[model samples]
Target: MLGQTAQLRYDFPFLVRTDSLSFRNVSLADAILFTLTVTLAWFISSSVCQYFRLRHFDGPLLAKISNLWLFSSVNSGRSYLDFWQVTQKYGTIARVGLNDLVTDDPAFVKHMCNVKTEYRRSSWYDGMRFNPTSNNCLSTRDEIAHSALRSKMAAGYVGRDVDNIEPKIDSNIRDFMRLLGSYADKKTPVDLGRKVQYFTLDVISDLAYGAPFGFVETDTDVYEYIQTTEKNLPMVMVVTVFPWLLTLLNSPVLKGLLPSTKDRLGFGRIMSIAKDVAAERFKLDVNDARDMLASFIRHGLTPTEAESEILLQIAAGSDTTASAIRSTMLQMCSNHDILHKLRREIASADIAGDIISDNEARKLPYLQAVIKEGLRIFPPIAGLMSKEVPPHGDTWNGVFIPGGTRVGYSIWAITRREDIWGADALEFRPERWLNNSPEKVKEMESTLDLIFSYGRWLCLGRTIALIELNKILVEVCS
Candidate 1:
């Protein structure tokens, strides 16, 4: 039996070889020693593989223990810099540490999701636990769990219930424009990114949790807490990428060693709120549908289930939209030619003086192009999407992405690769997306990064997001 398992294991890189070989002829005590010996061999070989360079690549310094630290090091703002630099030197793929592999290849995205839930969503997101009852869209690590919540929320996402979102978005944009106009009137150069963050927080919270978390409408230090929270997301995601280090970091005495205790407390506040809402909303029934809170109640999520779902929704929905808006505004301001062209396109539209209707906004082409360009340049959640390597491929592009090894898609790298996007790939040029030359357009999309990702795991809120964004961009810019 042991020999058979070993033979099957050899078909994949994730298997660790044990030197004790077998206990078939051994006494119970001797077999124990052999098991210990095998464990030690496995550890030694893995450590060596983690630290030393092989024929194909030299691992990054962080990679050496990046997995050990579980990427919770709080230094990923700079780590991102190291990652780009290393991937550059090592070519497109590099060994990220003991157990992680990050690849920037475009085709890799499709390849990674090949298996059904091949890789779990990671455990550290359990940090999202605001309360025991809290269960919403984002925190559930199981694909099966996510599907159940998504099905309940499908009315607000795929079906007519989301149609109500259209009016809600219109009102939010009106409020957003009013806020921005006041800033512009004072000649305030507000951080467009931060303001967009506040705007989306207000919008998505209104949609998801039944009202604003008061990120924008309310004046409190909680707003500051919200800002700090987003700035810490890349770091938070790092913890997800590498989890074992989190256990090490959480050691009682070592807790004080990290700089993100504020994040810990803020998450507590978020969970407490989720619990409060879930407790209150659980009493309501199906006909009570006023918003998403009631929708979940009707859909039959227990109060605790609803709370968790809320956590997931807020995490997934808010920041990405805000980032897209920030990137769009910056991209527009930076490119005068495209900017002027877009401005002209806006003015040329007959709806200029009229309240920009969503339907009318749909008529504008340049704005749509600009939005796509923004996603390409600065995708808000431009983090990696991970998967478990299959046994057949020990590694992609030469490095062994062992079967149990978690692999990631470097979103920024794929979007900017010369082979994928053309020589001016990194440039924020919207016109490149225009379908002028059939050959050129085909070349561009063959690199086909939707930025929202693709196929089964693709984002469901995409259509709603586009509608909300287009309405606001046109109304405000017009």
Candidate 2:
């Protein structure tokens, strides 16, 4: 026992010494190093996340606390309800994503849409190439390319040359009216929106491609193309969010995986049909049916260039007008009082027998109001039409938005601003436009409320759309 105690004392001291060494008090440097490691990890993790969040902008919830504030904005529904909610919270210069910036202020809009070279078409526009060759008119985003196409496009869309297409408009309108009897008789809850879509599709298709796909035939065989286009939206949005994946695989299979795949295929097929028509048109004697494609071809477009231009014409010419018509009917349905009043105004007009001949109907206050209101409420294509802010960046409402940031304009946000229009901003009051004093309208013209876009980049289809719209209204009213 004495021997064991002696050994225990020796070992016990050693053991205590070992424990004392291992559990030695932490030095100030040790604590500092530990804290520094943690802080570095946090910063690294946050920076990576911020980069990816901006890169893959499919609406991440983590954006609310991000430094850039883009995550706090744009993280909502694709619908107008969600858009307006965000705008209210974030103000006119709302951040939609880590890189997305939505501005509704007219001054900001003027700068983005009108100021040349400062804001270029976003990468998203490039991502929307339907065919191998890009078209001349709508898809040409740069000022120089746009300018080259616009001169010819303007001739076809506006002036006396376009005015001569009135008969076609009248005939199309008459066909629509003749079909309306069926709606009245059965009192069927006509998907007038869909029907109007068919009518516009057929009209534009016939004029642009030299053949309609029987969308407005007595057989009611329209809407196949529209259905295909509808299926493609999600695919496009998906591809936009993940452009790298698509760029890697340029195969049909890759494109098919896009959220807008259905739309791409659907529209691609229509463009194929358009190409077939162009093949035929290319061989024919050059006549006066300049449906934008012909304009491009006659002016300078070669066979290859013509193919691309024709496809673009077919897609843009039909889809935008169809979008406008659908929105117009929706507005008309929601406000039947406005609908009835517009109809009365139309009925009151003297058409001079030719439905498309007179500007007298266009001079009517209510019809113009309805068209403008519809565009304001539903500006057809939603989502940010991205712009690349110049290297110097952009300024909005006097605030500096950094360059290299992806910029966008929200139709849903802009049209619903209370600051510009007043308390009833959400309400569909045509009187704001139609009943305003003449001098006020002249001021508005100087400021120019451009729902169709502003500056040199405005839609080339405006004149045709307006004329056809007037003819349709006159036919319905008269």
Candidate 3:
């Protein structure tokens, strides 16, 4: 018994010493070193795994790590240029994010965006969603839902129906020209970009809500419209990479805490404007409402649905059209010969003094070419329009991309391709689109439509936008 007890005590002491060494004797420095070692190991293994996963494709190292590369590129306002550089280095299919590939190849653009393909808009669009739970037309990702909503809202934006809204556009354009005249009379330089934006905002507001925001007459952005849009747009680009962050940001508590000026400019405020317009129109029993909201309601949209649709129109339509207008104006100012030729065309028209009708402007070849050139040179939404590859996986430009990869066409790159448009592709030249041969012009038209985003998700406001652009160009040149 004594021998057994002695043996037990000896073993117990060894066990205690081992336990103390293993659990209780770890110093802070040691713990830190151990943690760092594990972390380094994990990082190396992860990088190696990622490298093998992306072995078929090529891109910068940072792009393979996380979405930060894309987020930073876009948030820094250099995505267009950055895309140019990356695509130049990596060729057609370059990894812009861990799962995102951007291609400049025109064939890839057609195949990926084709309606027959299984590509749908990626989660990046979710960043633009008003309510994380609910979706407006612009932010809806579901194909069937987008189709149904589009069909419901399609009649409201038909090209032929745009003539009915010509009066509203003319009124705003007259006010805008008068304001510009005042600026010219004073011999003071005006921020033409801001002025152009105000004009578009007023015009679109009139169409969407039945009344203008009064920016032209007041010569101010009364609702701080430009400031709000500027602040909020960056967030949309950021969340496109780190989409999980969207949920946290959109959470009520985080939103309340951060509380940016942009947050206040969300769908809630847009919806409020929509509600007020509807109330006023119904209260006054206004005769034969010609505005977009009325058209939406007439075409079977519920009150909430109508409000959502108009909100999309006002938010999406205003700034983009304004950008195109400003870009065209800037290009014209820089190119004196183009401006002179266009103005001469306008002056030769029989109704020179009167506001030119869209139909009449369409007949003016130079004007049409200028508009096409402007659209190609500065597509308003000049960033990646991401689409997710289908579950079956697909091959693009000879590279086999696995299923669920996010892919997009870089319109910025494609439009600037020197090979397609010649050495002067970077230069703003309208004649490229004015090819004399009908077949050649038809081909060019198809190319521009691709940049404007063709297929099932074609821009709905295209017809109205073209009409506005035609009239505004005539008025400005005159």
Name the top lDDT candidate.
3
Which prediction has more favorable lDDT, 1 or 2? 1
Best by TM-score: 3
Off-target runs (Cα >4 Å) in candidate 2 are 1-61, 64-80, 115-117, 132-136, 159-164, 183-189, 218-223, 252-265, 287-292, 354-358, 442-449
Tens-place lDDT digits, model 1, residues 314-384: 66677778777777877777777877888789888877434566677777878877777777787665455
TM-score of each: 0.77, 0.77, 0.86
Estimate the Cα RMSD of every predicted model relative to the unseen true structure: 9.1, 10.3, 5.3
Residue-level lDDT tens digits of model 3 in 1-478: 6565556556654322432333245568777887999999997787667656666777877888766688889899879888878898998889887778888887778887777868888887777664444477878889998888887777768733333588888889999999999999999999989999889888888888778978899998766666766876777677777678777976877865333323345444555676667666555432365556655665666666665666677778888899899999999999999999999999887664468888889999999999999988887876687888888888765678888788877887887777677688889999887754787677667777775576787888888889899999988876
Q: Candidate 3: lDDT over CA atoms?
A: 0.77
Each prediction's whole-model lDDT (CA): 0.63, 0.62, 0.77
Model 1, position 365: C-alpha lDDT score = 76
**TM-score of candidate 1 to 2 decimals:** 0.77
Residue-wise lDDT of candidate 2 within 1-478, one digit each (tens)? 6566556657654332332333335568777887899999997687676456444333334443353333222232253455456666766666555556565566666677774547877655654555633545554567687687677556656643443366666666667776777778888666676777777877776556655666666636444567766665555554443445446556676645433323334665676666676777678666665454565556665665566655555556667677777777777777788888988887776667756464775788777777777666666656566677888865655666677677666667777766555578778777788667787656444343465677766766677777777667656544
Superposition TM-score, candidate 2 onto the true structure: 0.77
Sorted by lDDT, highest first, which candidate order results?
3, 1, 2
